[model samples]
Target chain A: MTHLVVVGASLAGLRAVEAVRRDGFDGEVTLVGAEEHLPYDRPPLSKEYLAAEECPDPRYREEETFAGDLDVALLLGTPASALDTAGRTIAVGDRTLSWDGLVIATGAHARTLPGTEHLEGVHTVRTLDDAVALRAALRGGARRLTVVGAGFIGSEVGAVGRKLGLEVTILEALETPLARAVGERMGRALTHLHRRHGTEVRTGVAVEEVLSSDGRVTGVRLGDGTEVDTDVLVVGIGASPATDWLDGSGLTIDDGVVADETLAAADGVYVAGDVARWPNALFSDVAGGTMRLEHWTSAADQGGRAARHAVDPAAAKPYETVPYFWSDWYDGRVQFVGIAPEGADEQIEVVAGDDAQGGPFTAIYRAGDRIVGALAVDMPAEVMKYRRLIGGRKTWADALELAEQRRVQRAQKQAAKERGEGA
Target chain B: MRINVDWDRCTGMGMCESLAPDVFEVDDDGSLILHTEEISADQEGEVREAVAACPTEALSLDGPIDA
Candidate 1:
């Protein structure tokens, strides 16, 4: 039997293992995870898991799934220390394990504030322990919270803080929150929801330093020399792919483990999820190079594709996906499809419904005449519609027309819902 | 090639329309409207890609590619 070894007990790792079996590979599979607990969902750590009234286990699969449902071995809590490609083996602490095929799904880790590493009440959420600890801190009455980034993770954390009734303030270094992902115009629209939910949205600024007293973080100083007092600090700066273990393994590593269009890293080794950085022909056209997306859907899709490639290299196909992600803040929801305008050539802002507060709108990014990206606020169905357009290689004119149609339809639906409630 | 949609499975994500607007369109009310069921030689590649991109597994191709 061809034994396949997968590193990182993550969504990608789990999905890949499941995919190979589903495709009838019948190969021996072993999953090596760094975390002590079983694989669990990560997105909910910032939303549902963080905001839950009662804390619950976030395991992606139950005990039975590993024991009986799947034909796989689980090595939890220990990380692969090194990879020896020539010998086809990986070092997990003291023991050396051999494999016929290897998968590098060692995803990224949450970045930390420069000076707050050792300080109390400072956290970077990437694992179950981090989420559980953060939830405990909130439940333990830590107030006047401050978040250092306004990107997806930071914004979601800020919203969760507000839900817990913490005085939350989010600081973004860019001109707008999610400016790099959605563009300035639409990113500005997202700020409206934060204000309505009692979270301070401060843009065009950055967290300069974490204020500490007696080894506990008390506040943060912004780039403008303004100080904001806080009892808890959440650093949502960004992430770097965990490719350090492959140091002497000779795999090309730039921002991530460089992979080919087929998600192949080497002759017999493959990579997937946030760690696999490869050129996406569709989105990379205007952006100019490869990109690594760190969304849940990307992990799931690429995991299956990578596993398929691993099982039968001869039948491998280039991995191409229309990236999608959804976020929630209070009563509002934001969904993004394809790359944002920043990744494309030109940005075309479109509004369909009279939302009165910039809550409902669609902005499409165009590279020449082709629709390259889109951002939809409180409009998921439209995001899906735009995804089809982007995949279809439709023109900007078509996107604008479709946005107008969605806007009018959404407005009518909202009015009808209101009328129904009144009656 | 011919295209068949499992209407029950289609979430109306409309990624198909995004792939080949000439072939597919998902309206605002979350309904799918296929422009045509027949896939031309030129559109076979994109049409196949759209089927793969469908998140809900609602799309499938019935015949061999003319290309």
Candidate 2:
């Protein structure tokens, strides 16, 4: 019987196991996770999970989904400390387990900021326990809070902290929060969303030092000679792939695990999620090079694709799909699709919405005639519409009319709602 | 194949329409507008992908003609 060993029993690892079974692979499957608890969703840890003191369950699927429903064994708590890729064996403490096929779905870890190594009240939200700890600190009546990095995690954390009645301040090193993902114009719109949520936004500011009192984080000193005081500090700096175990294992490791478009890491070894930085076809379909997406949806989709390729490498299709993600700040939602054109963004961006009142508009990115990327605030449908346009490689100049029509329709609907006429 | 969408469960995320544009369409405010009730064979795969890809798990697939 073929034995499949999967490391990092996360969204990617769990879904990879399910994919293997769904593909009719009657093999002995084992999942190794570092965390002691069952597989839980991570996206909510910064949103709904932090919205209230008592929250809904964060587990992706019920235990029944893994118990009798799937033919797999769960090995939680112990991580794969070492791997002999050539020998097809992974060392988990004293146990030496070999596999017919291996998967490296270890995901990524939160990057820690300097000078906060042993400071109390400094936290990151990468795991369920981290969320619990942060929530506990906030619920314990921590008045003032400061968040580093205005990325999705930082933005969401700031929003949730305000919901918990904490005075929150978000600091971003870049001029705009999400410049890399949504470009500067759209990022400014998103920044307004955070500011509208009662969270103070500071940009182009670097936290040079973590001010502590008796080994507890008191605040952060900015590079621009500004000092922000806080009782609790949440670090959303970002994350790097959990590739420490694969050191000297002979697999190519760049920023993350470098893989081909097919998501194959090595011969029988495949990778998924934040760890696997494969050249994506969604972005490269129009342009030429590779891209990596760390969103939850991308991980789930790519995990399944990676497993199928691992099972039947010859019959597998290259993973090709539009990358998408959503971030809910206060009452407004920001949905983005595809990759934004790097460097010269102004020449390619054709925006169609106003950034007023938390920005309920859509901005489309184009490369030549075809659409490349899109960012919509409170315009989920437009994100979807543009995603199809980008996927279909449809010309954006042609769809601008439809975009205009939708804008008028939305304005009418909003007017009706304001006049107490529409639902 | 027959396509079904649970609006109560749909958060108007637009995963379906964006993924399988031929079958489903969403409005500017993320309201659903069914374009095609019966999915073509070629689009079945894409529709199923959309259904699976829905974050809320609000989409389901049913098919193979009752006859």
Candidate 3:
């Protein structure tokens, strides 16, 4: 029997094993995870998991599904220490497991503030344990919350802190927060969303040092010799791909485990999730280069696609997608689709709604003549439509036409609602 | 199969609509619109794929319903 060993029992790892069985691979499968808990959703960790009075169980499925239905051996809480790709063996703690097919879905680790690893009030939300601890700190009489980075995670955490009635402050080194993901214009608008709430946002400032007293975090020292006092400090700087175990495994590694369009990192080995850096065929012509998406949707999609290619190489096709991700802050949702263009010929415009107001709006990103990406503020259905256009490599004109159609639709809906009220 | 969405958990991520557009749609107001709750046998594979793709774990497939 073909025994497939899937490393990382998170979202990608769980989907990888499921895909293997779904594709009629009756092979013996062993799933190894660093955490003891079965596969659970991670997005909620920074949002709902942190805000809720009682923590919610976010497991994708129960324990019985993996053990009984999937018929796979579970090795939880034991992280893979090393990989011998030539011999097809993986070292997990003290045990060495051999496999015919391998799926590396190890994912990424949250980048914490240097020298604050042992600090009492410092936290990063990458795992369930991390979220639980952060939630406790937030609820445990934390009067002031300071987030080092103004990224999605930091923004969400800061938003939650405000909801919990804590004084919140966000520090970002970039001139404009979320500029890389949503362009300068939209990023500035999003930064306003934080200020609209009671949260204080300071841009173009770096945390020079983390200050602590009695082994607990007290505040942060800014680059310009200024200090911000805080009871809880969240380092949402970002993450580094967990590729330390594959140091000499011969798989090409840059920012992440480099893979081809097929997601094959090596012979009989596939990579998926946040760790897999592969060229998405959808933007092959856009010159966006190889991409690594940290979105939950991409993780699950790439996991299943990589597993199927591993099982049957002959039936493999190049994996392609219009990458998508959504972040919830306060009462609004921020969604982005496809890769945003950089440098010259890049155009970003508010296609629908008013960008001036801190309300619902849709912005489309363009490169040359084609629509490359879109950022939506509380505009969900409209954004997905643009995603389809991006996937089809539609022109800028096409995007404009679609935007007009949506505007008309919205107007008609509003008019009908008004007519009903008048009657 | 009967498609069920936990309205409480569904944040209109549109993963289901992306996988099986015919069965599901996210409206202008950002809420999921189930075109048909009772899906046919032929639609089972893609419907299952849609159910699996939901990030929020909101979508569920129930019954090969009794004829």
Quote the chain B TM-score of every prediction. 0.91, 0.85, 0.91
Q: For every candidate, what is the interface RMSD in angstroms?
A: 5.1, 3.5, 3.7
| Deviation from truth (RMSD, Å), model 3 | 2.0
Candidate 2 per-residue C-alpha lDDT over A189-252 given as tens digits, one digit per residue, 9 for 90 to 100: 7888877778999999988899999999999899988899999999998998899998989898
- The predicted structure with the larger DockQ, 2 or 3, is 2
What are the runs in model 2 whose C-alpha is more than 4 Å off?
A285-287, A348-351, A356-358, A408-423, B1-9, B31-43, B62-67
| Best prediction by TM-score | 3
Q: What is candidate 2's fraction of native contacts?
A: 0.76
Candidate 1 residue-wise lDDT, A1-423, digit = tens: 398888988888988887787677777888899988888878778776888898666776886897676888999889899998889899998989998878889999888877678898998778889988888877788878888889888888899899888999998888777767777666777788788788998888877788899999899888889899998888888999999999999889998999888998887788989899988877665667888989877887788788778778888888877788777677566778888655332355665543236666667778767887777676545777777788777898998888778768777978988999999
Per-prediction DockQ comes to: 0.19, 0.52, 0.51
Per-residue CA lDDT of candidate 3, range A1-423, in tens? 388889999999999999878667888899999899999999999998899978888888789999888988899998899889899999999999998888899999999877999999999989999998999999999999999899999999999999999999999999988888777778888988899998999999989999989998999999999999999999998999999999889999999999999999998889999999999988878766899989998899889888888777777789998888999999789988888777522488788877766558888888878898988888888787887788888999999999999889989989999999999
Better of 1 and 2 by lDDT: 2
Q: Which stretches of candidate 1 lie over 4 Å from their true place?
A: A343-346, A354-356, A411-423, B1-67
Error of 2 at A213 (Å): 2.0
Calculate model 2's interface RMSD in Å: 3.5
- Candidate 2 residue-wise lDDT at A102: 81
